[model samples]
Target chain A: MNGVHDLGGSDGHGPINPEPNEPVFHAEWEKRVFGMFLPVAACGYFNLDEFRHAIERMGAPSYLNTSYYEHWLHAFETLLVEKGALSAAELAARQQQIAEEAR
Target chain B: MASSAHTRPLSEVEIRVKALESLLVEKGLIDLAAVDALIDKYEHKVGPRNGARVVARAWVDPAYKARLLSHGTEAIAELGYTGMQGEDMVVVENTPEVHNVLVCTLCSCYPWPTLGLPPVWYKSAPYRSRVVIDPRGVLQEFGLQLPESTEVRVWDSTSEVRYMVLPERPPGTEHLSEDELAALVTRDAMIGVTKVSA
Candidate 1:
């Protein structure tokens, strides 16, 4: 499926802000997400295309608001549910735990 | 006493990753240890520095540059950098007459081995969508201002192939050695979002 992830020449996205001495990753969560996404992806539930499509499959509000790795995070949830490894209810509960803990 | 890691709450993505990782690991679907190692490799090793080495080598060796432009995979593999998403590499050279920039209109199909993980902007919706439509305007945003006579070619990478930009070597830098030249090559230069200069 051609998703929003494919942004080859549309418009309205803003300027690119580059950092001096940029690091490979900025945050700890980013690293964990990348590590998990890549290996689980290699585990064969879906090919690269399927994985990307899962990201594309996200609702517009969530997709537009999410960061890059957040897209990967949402995709992980989507793939797990789609592949029968997870359920929407379970993901919702996990998200709730963090939300409640932060309260 | 607990470490700082415990005091700080994980981000939403981090929390989800932890939850998913535990679930996946419990199902015997993935090896957490191995995943950690892979992240370490990308974080510490196999980064833009690796691509910088390639750019530097090409700058010093004309034949190698020719081979790189013609057979990107083999030339890159010669440097011992080869893997998924980069198996079919296409090295486009940025010259005085033409400038080459890379974007994955479909998704961020970047060369992981050479450039490491793409920048946030590379994966952001704006960069993905805007670069192809108005490369000159986008170039201006990236601080690259090319003359009208110079052609800006934006390569839209598909799943079949990935691309890397070979930036033009700046003038008066001939005295620098191959390693030094490579040192000057930035990831943006390689992506054709910017240039390499002294």
Candidate 2:
């Protein structure tokens, strides 16, 4: 079997190359949401001060479990529902409308 | 940091914010240069030095390394840097025998507290898939050549948690102080592609 590095190239095996300096929508959102939700998430779940202390303690990970965009989507969805900005039913309805519109 | 108020997807709030940005560009409520300046300011001021300090400390102190492995964030705060992106972190250590590497396989889960923003490569799918399977080869591309006997461990970062690598300290630095040790801790070392050198 080919190693992981061998997977991205023109033959549809390797990873596709993105344009240099391209602005990524997902990453932009991830950075925004990370900055926004981290404080609240830390305070409500883990101890706020302790949480900050822990983060400065390590280096980068080998892999991320979810896409950066997913984190933004997750945080946004959670906060929207929590703050009554959008009800679960409304979200479901909007998703259905979008899906139907696509069809 | 702003409150978690704009989390919803495709909502009116986000649209309004975008619209406002556009309007500011059109009507000059805010200059584009000023906005760019603000972004740069935060990116630099709140970036990953805190995490780098932790990695540097672990390199110099064995006991601190033990503490970092057990309780990463708390261990880091012992050095007096706290708040923001560092609320949650996990420490993965590398040794001469077993090298630890980091990749954001899914998207770009990074230890923002220490490292600041994830580099563009970390967020790319190619780096994510390639690193986990052929870490030695990837390291080679990054100008790192490891022995075959060195085992590679790849950690996957998630939304709830982040990770950082504690690279082994290089030789010829026994006489160096902690501040000197910190200088040797390059961003690549913390990512596990390179080791600290004299």
Best by lDDT: 1
Kindly list the per-residue Cα lDDT of model 2 for residues A1-103, writing each as its tens digit. 2332222221322542434443323344344444444333432433433333233222234113344444344444545455554466766665555434333
Per-residue C-alpha lDDT of model 1 across residues A1-103, encoded as one tens digit per residue:
5555555666676676656677778888788788887778777888788887887888767777888778888788888798888888887787778656754
Per-model TM-score on C-alpha atoms = 0.92, 0.59
Pairs in steric clash, model 1: A6-B105, A6-B106, A7-B128, A7-B129, A9-B129, A9-B133
* RMSD, candidate 2, Å: 11.2
Give the top-scoring candidate (DockQ).
1
Lowest summed lDDT window (length 10), candidate 2 chain B: B15-24
Interface RMSD for each predicted structure:
3.3, 11.0
lDDT of 1 at A20: 69
Residue B18 of model 2: what lDDT? Answer: 40
Docking class for candidate 2: incorrect
